[model samples]
Target: MAKIVNREEMAQGTIILNEIIASRISRKAKPGQFVILQADETGERIPLTMADTNPEKGTITIIYMVIGKSTARFKDLKVGDEYFALIGPLGKPTHVENVGKVVCVGGGTGIAVLHPITRALKAAGNEVTTILGSRSYDLLIMEEQMKAASDNFHICTDDGSQGHHGFVTDVLKDVLEKEEIDLVVAIGPIPMMKFCSLITKEKNVKTLVSLNPIMVDGTGMCGCCRVTVGNDTKFACVDGPEFDAHKVDFDELGKRLASYLDDEKQSLEAYEKANKQ
Candidate 1:
């Protein structure tokens, strides 16, 4: 049983941060690797990327949105509570290189997932530029850490609540035109990542994206994390959670992601109703 030593709510509680004690996992964890955690004895297994870690403190932090039934149950967990199961450091890590100028784009909760990789890029001597976006100011996260890792940092809000008054692509396009980008990495909602890939493709910039399809098993055996990269099937859990965005088929990924939307809503509704008692 891994104990959650700390918990924080961000993005107006739409996102929750849980820092669980796992010394072994922390020491071996790398950016882009994830953990499959069960909320309780009978809870479904859910996978989440490691947002940050501290081996000295024996903790690995993960940030997640309260999107569906499992996460909603996760929201009910408090600090000092223990997880049902914590399996970790899964998926291949991202490749880091000093490719001169690199641009990192992160949206919503993905910002946290991208943070460590961005920091690694900076440390590797690549000039890092980061673009972060969310629906509004309140939804924005990890501003200071990202700014610290980046040589240049840009932000956008869909509602113009803060920073640029439009989509992140608006800023990204401007950057791409004015500068030479050696590499681009994006992680976000399927639509946002797809759009980022589309734009980067037109510019002929090499781009990478972190894919989060429906994953029942963190290992490749379940086949739930299958995704098409260049029209060939790849398992996100094993082959990659990171793949060349230009080669991915976002249309198929998007449809598969929405498969449980209705069930999620019904579960959320039931949870709320039960909690009112």
Candidate 2:
């Protein structure tokens, strides 16, 4: 069992961040890797990308939106509580390089996954520009931390409650036109990533996207986190949770992700009802 060392709520309590004591995983985790965690013996395994790792503290942080039953259970976990199971440092780490100029785009809770990668890119001596977005100002997270990690930072909110009035793609379009960009990294909802990839592809910028399809065992053996890249099937767990954005089949991934939504909703409802009882 992994002990929860710290917990914080963000995005108006819609998102939860937990720092779990996992010394080995914390020591080896990288920017793009994820962990599979179970709330209890009966809880379903859910994969969450690492938001940060404190090797000195022997803890790995994970930030996730409480979207379904598994995450709802995760949200109920308090500091000093122990997870039933936590396995990680999974997936291939992001290939951080000294690419000249990088624009990192994140949406919603994806900002958590993008955090460490942006910091790593900046540390590698690349000029990093980060664009983050959500529905409104209150929903935006890690703004100050993101700003510190990036050489340039911008915000976008759908309701015009924050920086740019439109999507991150709108700001990205402007940046692509005005600046010479060497690389682009986007992590968000599949649709957001898809649109960002479209823009970056048109600009001929090398782009990488992090994929989080439904995962079971979190290892290659499960074959559940499969994604098609460059017309070839690859497991997101072992091969990558990160892939060339231009080559990914986002449509298929979207469909696959939606496949279990009805079931998930039913499960959440039942769990809530049982809790009330």
Candidate 3:
């Protein structure tokens, strides 16, 4: 059983958990890897990227937004609560090398996943710049952690509630115009990442994006998390949750993500009705 060491609300519907797991997984985890978790015996398994890991402490941190029935149940868990299954340290690690002047952009909950990658880039002798954004200041998560991971950081919100009064892409464009950046890494909602990739395309900067598709099995056998990259189908579970942003088909991915919306709504409604009774 994996015990939840701590749980805190980072935003209105987002929660971050520090959980204890087996030593083996912790030791193998690298930046950009993810894990499959089940809250209880009857719960469905869900894939979440590893936000941070402490090998010495044998603990892993995951930050998630509560958007579905399974995630809602996860949010109900408190400190000291035990998880039924925490199968982890999965997927390919980000290909980290000292690619000069790297810019890491994260939106909403993606900041958590971007944190470790930024740290890895810095350690690899690369100068790192980070941009974090959300709809409003109150919805932003992991600003401090991301700031600490990079040499330079910028924050953006849709409203002028904090930092720059525009999207992360706006800040990214400004920075790219001024600085000679070698590589760009972005993770967030599909639309946000898509736009970021578009902006970077104009500058011809190499951009990588982390994808979150509808995944069933964390392994390749399920075929549920397949995404097209450069006209080839790749499984997100095993092949990547990260791929070249310029080659990705965002329209197809967005359609695939919406395929389960109705089923998810029904499941949530049923779960709520049963609980109320």
Candidate number achieving the greatest lDDT relative to the actual structure: 2
Q: On residues 110-220, what C-alpha lDDT tens digit does candidate 3 reach at each position?
A: 888898899999999999999999999999988888888899989898998999999999999999999999999999989999999999999999999988787777889
Q: What do the candidate models score in CA lDDT, each in turn?
A: 0.92, 0.94, 0.88
lDDT of 1 by residue, 137-218 (tens): 9999899999999999999999999999999899999999999899999999888899999999999999999987778878
Q: Candidate 2, which segments miss by more than 4 Å at Cα? A: none
Q: Give candidates' CA RMSD values in order.
A: 0.8, 0.8, 1.4
lDDT of 3 at 49: 90
In candidate 2, which residue pairs get closer than 3 Å at backbone N, Cα or C atoms, i.e. clash?
none
Query: Whose lDDT is higher: candidate 1's or candidate 3's?
Result: 1
Error of 3 at 9 (Å): 1.2
Worst 10 residues of 3 by lDDT: 13-22
| Selected candidate, larger TM-score, 1 vs 3 | 1
Q: What is candidate 3's CA lDDT for residue 47?
A: 89
Native RMSD of candidate 3 (Å) = 1.4
